[model samples]
Target chain A: MTFDVEIVRWHAVASWTWNAGDDVCGICRMPFDGCPPDGKYPGDDSPVVWGVCGHAFHLQCIQKWLQSQAQTDQRCPFCRRAWEFKAAAPSS
Target chain B: MIKLFSVKEKQKKDAAAINNPKQSAGELRMQKDMSELNLAKGTTISFPDGKDKLLHFEIFLKPEDGIYKAGTFHFDFQVPTSYPHEPPKIKCKTKVFHPNIDLDGNICLNILREDWKPVLSINSIIYGLQFLFLDPNPEDPLNKEAAEMLANNKAKFESQVQAAIQRGAYIGSNHFPPCR
Candidate 1:
């Protein structure tokens, strides 16, 4: 007697979600799991970063937004408050 | 082998999507934002293009304090397809004697220009516009004469503001349409 093994593809929906209820990144209006425009997947690039204001965005989106801002008004684009990272590691 | 697997995946996705057509990411976000809009007192929102066209709408601000008190002003908000990333283009449809707002209906607001962020909702923009009526910023004004008048003579500025509220009050030469 012989036995055969059957393989199946399993799918899971992982939301790059924050404490906030929004499923999409507020900056890019793109789904958290999906990559930003002209972006690659499953890498250090364009990962989600959370602000101290409890808002979250794509790392690349916030970086580009912050660069164009003046020093006096260097704040999060979403809440119009001072930009503070929830996780210190994301800043580096 | 890869091509065959990709075709099979596409077919699976198509079958899954057939039951319910997907809305663009922008539409879903807009829906969420619109549903959560918390308009202030004396402020009302209207959509001329029906409920389906969420991108175009008008905000009526009846500033009940300061110089603009009791004056009804209409503002047009046009949200682009690339919203959240891009700020909405806002314009004053009701011409009033305002330093930050011009005769051509262009407004000088930081959020509408360089300072806009994705986190800002329609409620924030409405408040910004209302703040202009309560305290018009002469420091950064779109109307030079209005700014100058507001800076030089407080009495004259008050008079001018009153005159502007009157039906068809002429400021020097140009006529301001009577706002109801």
Candidate 2:
């Protein structure tokens, strides 16, 4: 699928303007955007994490997302889909 | 408005987390190994459960040449978190009577099993599967009877393959998933 930069930019700007004090990437719901200066969000090259709904996040961010929701229940913080670590097979 | 709402939610969640740092480190990783993926034409990927669930994805393989021409097979890939380090578990959800695939929908492909390597990508595995349909190997047989027949008698093997594919029962075995 072709990504429309203008559409993404417009959405990002609009989201920023309305939220006023949020640092989330509107599309991913994650706080990091790989842009410099503030750098609250982890830079790219961090281990990528995927939700059961197919959305992805940086490992650090997702771990934090999961930790935040620990009190209520165990579900994906974004989509609430049941999430589990894929079990690794024994190495030969 | 929708975009704004999502950003706000993210911020609220972030704030809530700062106050309570105790939570499960629930993390899942399912990125396809790009270096190993060797997709050919007519193969496509689908999320099915939106973009959030990448571990449970589907791949459509349409063979252009083989006894199973013009046929579409669906394979479900369940990638474990240790992917790239460990091979994803793949199963042929489509049922076809072949020497390499047993009646119970189990596939006897090497890449899916002992031969898997971190260097192999989704595309490479898919191509390997497609190759099985195009050229059913009898030497390493999952369906030993079919393999024996094919190895011993070429004509009988062809007849059995044709009969099974045409939705006809072979040797009292009734019903096969329609592939026409």
Candidate 3:
């Protein structure tokens, strides 16, 4: 697949610049940095992943998006890529 | 050199934990739900990105036998942190002519609105959207003229739908972007 340099750079900058302080949840546009003491980050410490050619969001966030689909064959809601979750790394 | 190595190893360990199987509650529930999705024949889903990121995705709808038959439509869905309790925001990326869809690609689907329930799954919404094309309800109209035409004159409504699908402009005051 072809990559758009500008788009990639933009998202790269976005990912780096995200301090969780200014980081907004891609789904709700809510701030993710240091959420309320009681409230939690949706994915715990899981790194937020952006679709190759699309916007960024947490893995859990995207998983929720997929689950919301009425059909089981639903793919990613942004780029239409098949949604697959990575297996948990084996513990040492 | 010893200190630097230790720091690097720590960071790697931290990263591993973050990507571990013990996900948050929200993520666990989401996983369970996604594994159970059952889409229709012409519909497909994509991640745009790989499996690492999960926030943004796309849904493609190809209506085989409706006013929108032979046409393809795409919708983008963004899921927020407080899911299940909140509905994902969906936008039609493909501009199409329909009484329920505006020029800006804002869909007038009930599932995305007041009718939404926490129990409603993604499969329900997709079917609801597909049903909209198969049967456009003129009662809760988004495009007033189209609704009125469909309500008052069925023949004119069908013709208008055909014209719009064929890339011809309708008689409405607002002009639609070509979907063909």
Reference-based lDDT, residue A54, model 3: 41
Chain B TM-score by candidate, in order shown: 0.84, 0.74, 0.77
- Cα error of candidate 1 at position A22, Å: 9.3
- Which tens-of-lDDT digit does each residue in A20-88 have in candidate 3? 333754443334442321245544554555544444455555556667765666454545565555444
Runs of candidate 1 with Cα error greater than 4 angstroms are: A1-47, A51-55, A58-75, A78-92, B1-22
TM-score of each: 0.69, 0.53, 0.56
Residue B124, model 1: Cα distance from true site in angstroms: 0.6
TM-score of chain A of each: 0.66, 0.40, 0.40
Displacement of the residue B127 alpha carbon in candidate 3, Å: 0.8
Give, for candidate 1 chain B, the lowest lDDT window spanning 10 residues.
Answer: B20-29
Candidate 3: TM-score, chain B only: 0.77
The residue-level lDDT of candidate 1 at B16 comes to 82
Report the number of the highest-lDDT candidate.
1
Candidate 2, residue A84: how far the Cα is off, in Å? 35
Model 2: runs farther than 4 Å from truth? A1-92, B1-38, B159-172
State candidate 1's DockQ. Answer: 0.29
Query: What tens-digit string does per-residue lDDT give for candidate 1 at B3-115?
Result: 99999999999888786655544555577678879887878999999987788899999888888777789999998766666788998998877789999899999988887
